[model samples]
Target: MTIAAAAPVMLCAWLPTAPGAATATAALAGVAALALALWQMLRRLGVPDPDRAAALILLLPSVALNGVIGAHDTLWAAILLLALVAALDRRHDAMLGWAGLAIGLNPQAGLTAPLFVALLINRRVPLLRWPIAPLAAAAALLGTGSVGWTIGLRPLLHEAITGHLLAIDAPNIWTIVQTLPLGYPLLGLAIAIAIGTIATVIAHFAARPIGDHDMIAAALLCTMLAAGLLPLMHERAFFLADILSLALALVRRDRAHWRIALLVQAGSTLALLGHASGIDALTILGGGMTIAATALLAGPLLRPAANDNPVIARSA
Candidate 1:
């Protein structure tokens, strides 16, 4: 999956510098990554050939969005997610391949999901191998002058890390509400959110009935929300949530939960559409909606099996 996925990125590395080179490179990379991901997913789930077409139908809108919007980061992020899922299903090679795709493109790409999977699988392997890819990629990009030192490596690295400061000059929606008094009320919000998060973690783990995949979905959702909530969150940071949300939808298998999961994707699309404010509205509104939707879709989990799946019944 990684070789096939990264092939386009590798090819783009050779494209003559042009006005749309980066965007074009990103587009090719996105398509390749999406194709590999879908193929791997179809294989892993053993979706019947007929159903496979339907699955691709659901996926096409997203794939098309990635290509058209040049959202390579999120596209690649989704690839990492599929890899992680593949690994969880015991497809370790695909996981490594997905991670390779990330390293070849962005160091921070799907970095968390693979590490999480490593912990779930063989912790030691992820600990040792994950960093190697990005580090080596960085060195190569610098050493081989794929990124020219003057206008490329140094500046790219500098901008990649420090550029956010220039891009984002204020607090995000969550911060705005939390810091209503202004002047970095972040301290209080940070402490409260931390406490709440820790408590949720404890509860989630202590409950123990929660499946490993469920826990992973929850963690991704938490991380996705945090990425957006943090000060100086650029539009790009939301890409971090791409896989986790999809994972949540697939693994949870509750229509309501799936709808909630869709919010992250929606938010991401809004960001690409230059609608950060809209994304903020959706996140805030969507959180409440997800809980209600979950209650309806997954009520059986909280009730007797006789509930007949409220969502499915309603739809019928």
Candidate 2:
């Protein structure tokens, strides 16, 4: 809560007269920043057409929902993109800083931290420099004081442990299995760890030096894994994965990838709309779309690399 509170405080300071205005303004700014970051990442990845890339990003339903709803997720999306840009640029300090801010805002951000670490390792970055994220998170903790942890971390952990945080309301596998006689928390944690490990290995071996494609692919995989396997994930948790998939589709210009992106967007949109309308059927359809999209994308992402394609190779 303390970390998420930073957005409102920062935005409201500039628009004291209207808190709603501040939130809307922040969401707009976050959307713009996210587009810019995506553009930069696509360029860095050697996309043939920048305009198409921008269109693809702007057209994503998840992006549109976040922008219009003025959810804090818009800001988190921007932060994640900026961190990806920093990693692509080989700016280790900047990557760590953005990632730290992400972690401060939501512990879920830690799920993607290993992708950055993989990037650093692929580039042979010093192990000593890796501590920057933890240090920055500690600094955020110190700045917030003990009250932050007491109010924030405790509840978050409790929700996670008891399966209270499961994405049963979302169109996800959890929704299907939730009613079954099983130990949910343990099952969810085991699945998350297993999938996360596979994603990390794929990220490490797929691209030497870790290009934008590799980073984005790894992020998409990890985000999907988290959303599908975490005990208490929300449907909105797939927003990052949806965005990354769109970006990947645009960059790769592959028909199949583009189709996968469309599936993700459709699924996310249905889930969001269904949740709003209290329609369980629509929610199930949405979750099925997500599962299909993730499955389709996993093949290309997890396939053994023939060689590091230099065109999409990392500058670092």
Identify the candidate with maximal TM-score: 2
Best-fitting candidate, measured by lDDT? 2
Residue-wise C-alpha lDDT for candidate 1, range 36-132, written one tens digit per residue: 5645554454434523432442463445565565545544554565655555565555566555555445544533442444243433344565554
What's model 1's lDDT at 303?
Answer: 33
| Angstrom error at residue 172, model 1 | 6.7
Model 2 lDDT at residue 232: 61
Clashing pairs in 1: none
Model 1: worst 10 consecutive residues (lDDT sum): 307-316
Name the lDDT value of residue 186 in candidate 2. Answer: 58
Instruction: For model 2, state the Cα shift of residue 312 in Å.
Output: 9.6
lDDT of 2 by residue, 1-316 (tens): 2223234423432454455666677677667666666767777778878656765667777777776665656555666777877777778887887788666655666656657766776677788888888787666555434322222244457756674534646667666666457754555464766576656654655355455566676677666756755556655767777788888787667788788888888888888887678886777788888889878866655555535344234332
* Model 1, CA-based lDDT: 0.47
